[model samples]
Target: MHELGIMTGVMESVETAARDAGATRVLEVRLTVGEMTEAIPDALEFAFEALSEQNELFDGAKLLITMVKPHSCCLACGAEFDHDRFHMFCPQCDSFALELLAGRELHIDSIEVDLPDD
Candidate 1:
């Protein structure tokens, strides 16, 4: 699944950041994912677990995901509403002209790491 590739990239970035910050270990990773990306939560978690186990920095690290619903704005009626992936049409005017306001994001929000003590 594409989730593997996605997690691979995420792990690379996280590892680099943690090392650069002198982090001894990663505590948690918070990710914001949107429904439009179609990335399954379970798959992502599985991928994270598999990848994290390979790295010492990620031992016992927690992966927290925040799911974002699809939200769009109607270009015709200037109305905003939430919708599913299949239905993107504006509910107020029934127009197909819509601009997506959210639900297409796949990014790391924050990372909690244990830094070296002085």
Candidate 2:
């Protein structure tokens, strides 16, 4: 799955950070993903687990994901509202002309690691 590649990138980035900070091992990872990004949490978790088992630094690391719903503003009425995935329209003016304000993000929020001295 594409999630495997995504998870690999995430682990690589976090591992670099953890190593730079003198960490011996990663303990946890927190990520923020938007609905519009279409990254499945379950699949992401599976990928993470699979990668963790293959990596020495992330063998026991935990992954925590936070989902952000799509938020949009109607271009016609300038009204902001949550975008419904099924309808794909602005609720305020019922218009299809919308500017997405959020829900297209995928980033690491935080990482917990075991420092050499700790």
Candidate 3:
């Protein structure tokens, strides 16, 4: 699954940040998955668990994901509606020319790390 590669990249970035901050271990990684991203949260988590086996920093890290729904704005009637990739038309005026407001956001929201003691 594509989630494997995506999770790998995420973990890499998290690790880089953790290292820069002098962290010896990553405790948790929080992500926000938008409806339009087409990413499976469970699959990503599974991939993280599998891929992190060789990595000491993220070996036992927790992954938390939050799903965000797609939103659309109609240009014709200046209306907005919750949208999905399958149905992008505006609900209020049945307009096909709807601009997406929020969606397709696959980002790391927060990272918790254990810093090395001084």
Candidate 2 weakest ten by summed lDDT: 83-92
Point out where model 3 deviates above 4 Å.
none
Candidate lDDT (C-alpha), each: 0.96, 0.89, 0.89
- What is the C-alpha local distance difference test score of candidate 3? 0.89
TM match of model 2 to true structure: 0.94
What stretches of model 1 exceed 4 Å from their correct place? none
User: Each prediction's TM-score against the native?
Assistant: 0.96, 0.94, 0.94
Best by TM-score: 1
Show model 2 residue runs off by greater than 4 Å.
Answer: none
Question: Which digits, one per residue and each the tens of the lDDT, describe model 3 over residues 1-118?
Answer: 8899889899989989999999999999999988787888899889989977979998678999998899988999999888777998888888898788888889999999999889
1-118 in candidate 2: lDDT tens per residue?
Answer: 7788888999999999999999999999999988887889999999999888888999788999999999888899999888646667876667899888989889999999998764
Can you write out model 1's per-residue Cα lDDT over 8-87, one digit (the tens) per residue? 99989999999999999999999999999999999999999999889999999999999999999999999999999999
Residue 62 in model 2: lDDT: 95
- What alpha-carbon RMSD in Å does predicted model 2 have with respect to the real structure? 1.2
Worst 10 residues of 1 by lDDT: 84-93
